[model samples]
Target: MEIVMSGIAKAFGTNQVLRDVSITLKEGEVHALMGENGAGKSTLMNILTGIHKADAGTITIDGVERTFPNPREAELNGVAFIHQELNIWPNLTLLENLYLMRPKRNKFGMLDKKAMLAEAENTCRELGIELPLTTEAGLCSVGHQQMTEILRILMLDAKVVIMDEPTAALTERETATLFKMMRKMKARGVAIVYISHRMEEVFSECDKITVMRDGHTIITKPTSEISVDEVVRHMVGRSIDEFYPARTTTPGEVVMSVDNLKPEGFDNDISFSLRKGEILGVAGLMGAGRTEIMRAIFGVDKHNGGTVTVNGSVLNCKKPEDAIKAGIAFITENRKSEGLILDFSIGSNITLPNLDDICPSHVLDSGKLNSFADELSKKLGVKTQSIHEPASSLSGGNQQKVVIAKWVGKKPSIIIMDEPTRGIDIGAKRDIYDLMNELTNDGVSIIMVSSELPEVLGMSDRVMVIHEGRVAGILDRSDATPESIMTLATGGQ
Candidate 1:
């Protein structure tokens, strides 16, 4: 089936989100939609999946005009959307979540449990996903949860699958598995619309590329005819040569040291030293305890046993506040939930951590707060009309900047970032890389957790691969090849 969208226009009062956007997806081909954070990619996908209705447009599937008032209607018509944020019920078992809508009933009008389990198990195996059927969705790892979502779409027998940031939380091996599944879907004549910020994935996996900019369609070209630079140029209206800035200063004395760190679900005797002016990368599979380790180090999670020494002085950290007061900042992986207070204004969010600095003598100093927010916003190149606007109104990239600014105001000696560049666009990613370089030059030690191999390899002075709650291996920059890291991450050595 061919999916054709023409003259799509949508708006939220005075904010026009999409205008004159057009795209087409042919059966058996993967079409990638690339754009900046505020670009109309998500809006357009929502309109296609019936999450949002287009104010003006014509959607023709298989040469027949159709109307979808809701997602159920679209699903019934063979369209399914795998959102970036998985919508699985955490409390439900994998089989239950997968077969939630479609249930086989016995002759007595009772639910057919055995058949459902068998079908779910078979589907998962065929997709090369090894998820326990009886395990609760919440108990499964992030990678498994993602696989469950993909299985749900497959179970629906959807003809057109729209995947939004499908590989955002996936590790290298899991990403390879997803690519294989995508190829299988294409072989089965399913039209796939892939939305992603990673340019390499777009060029490597997509048959055609559609670039969107500021609520409008820029162009749609065959993948063979375009390069990553060209696509990024169209998305941001500028060319960025060095995504990761060159390191300015060499690493000095060790600033932070962790020895024999042991947290729940991660029992490995982890020992590592972070020196000033160095960025250390933590790479692992989704369940490999990378985030848990960071959380424990930053006192967001309790450590069963460990010793943390900063500047040769042992520090007691039992809570996030303790870590903050001890000159450590943590940027969470899920920025929306853990990092920012979305309802607050940009200034409020940025100044939340350092309220005392902005408001001395128990008096609220709005002027100082605004000045700090403005300075950080300008420094980070956060695109916004006003500092008083709600943080929720900004794009994902800008929201991330607000999180960074909030912590940067504290001027922590050590910073831990988990998936810092997860959902942002290319332009914002470059900005973040530049910021990391600047911070390192200022002698701040950084501990970064990322699932993207290229980013882990490019930004880190040394890479640590974790697997199954253990430090699988540690490699210096010169030895941190993709093959080498994967070998350790997958337990090959």
Candidate 2:
């Protein structure tokens, strides 16, 4: 299949998202779509899949000009879009979630569970994917949910597949499996539109690259002809000399400590300590209980046996509010569902947690609320025209900024950041890194749980490896290498 989108343009009211953008995807090619948040990459894809109409553009698929009425039609026509967000019914079993929209029926008009199971098993076997079909999707880990979505696209047998940050939640092994499947699909003459913010994956896997910036297509060329530095320059219009900002401040005395912490579903007790003005990065595989430990610390998940101490005071936190009052904040991994409300305005989301501080006199102070939100938004470098715009209006990176802004307003002594830069662009990631440096300089402590090993090594003053719900080993920044971290993460001695 060959898809050529030329002169594409789209606008939402006064905001023009995509203007004069073009790209070409050939059969059996893995074409990378690289851009910063709000750079119109998703908007262009939406237009192609018919979720949004292009005001001025020509879409030619397989040498014939055509337009899809909706995403369903596009999928039926062999163009599948695996969105960045997981589209799973938490209450439904994996098998039911897989065949939710279209189910096979028996001759008597009954659901054919046998046939569905047989087909699903065959596909999973082919892809070397192992998942419980009977388990509710909510009970499964985020990596499993991500694999399910990818499996759905593979089962579709689409001629053109658009994958947006497909490996964001996947482990190293799962990512290898996904890349293997992509290779197989390519051999079968399927064209894949791969979208990710990970430079290493793009340069290693993609055949061609298309860079977009500020609603315009900057350049499109073969991957072999371009370097990561050049691609970043095109995407952000400047070369980033430093990827992760260096941490200059030395860690102070311990500000928080967890001893003998044992959350539900964990057999092994966990323990750790965070120093003032320090970044304690938690690193491990997808299901290594990194996020679980963070949740337990923040009081979102109760620990059956543990002690959490802050400022030399032993504390028992029963809920999130208790932790919040104890000067702790948590930035969850799933930003869309947990971090910010899509329907709410950006300003409202930022000021929601600090309402008491803004309206101290027991009165609604609109001016104070607006000013507080605006100040934080600007401080975090959120690229939005107005704080009054709905959070859904901003791109993924900007929404993450709002999430950080929301938590930072609380002036918490300890902050837990989970997957702080999962799907953001290079420029936005640098912004967050710089922000972390600033926060730590101000004597604030951070516990960052991340799946990205490079991020863990780059920003952490101390890297704590977790394995099977237990602390494996904590290494100093100078001593922490990729091999050392992985060894400890995989239950090494």
lDDT of 2: 0.92
lDDT of 2 at 226: 97
Candidate 1: minimum summed lDDT over ten consecutive residues — where? 240-249
lDDT of 2 by residue, 1-493 (tens): 8999999999989888889999999999999999998899988999989899999989999899999999999999999999998989999989988998789899999999999989999889888989888899999998999899889878886999999999999988899999999999999999999999999999989999999999999999999999988999999999897788888989999999999999888999998899999999999988899998888888899788989999998878888998999999999999998999999999999999999988988797989999999999999998888999999988888999999999899999999999999888888899999999999999999999998999999999999999988899999999999999999989896
> Which candidate's TM-score is highest?
2
Model 2 misplaced regions, further than 4 Å: none
Colliding pairs, model 2: none
Instruction: List, residue by residue over 388-417, the lDDT tens digit for candidate 1.
Output: 999999988899999999899899999999
Clash totals for all candidate models:
0, 0
TM-score of every candidate: 0.95, 0.98
What lDDT score goes with residue 43 in model 2?
A: 85
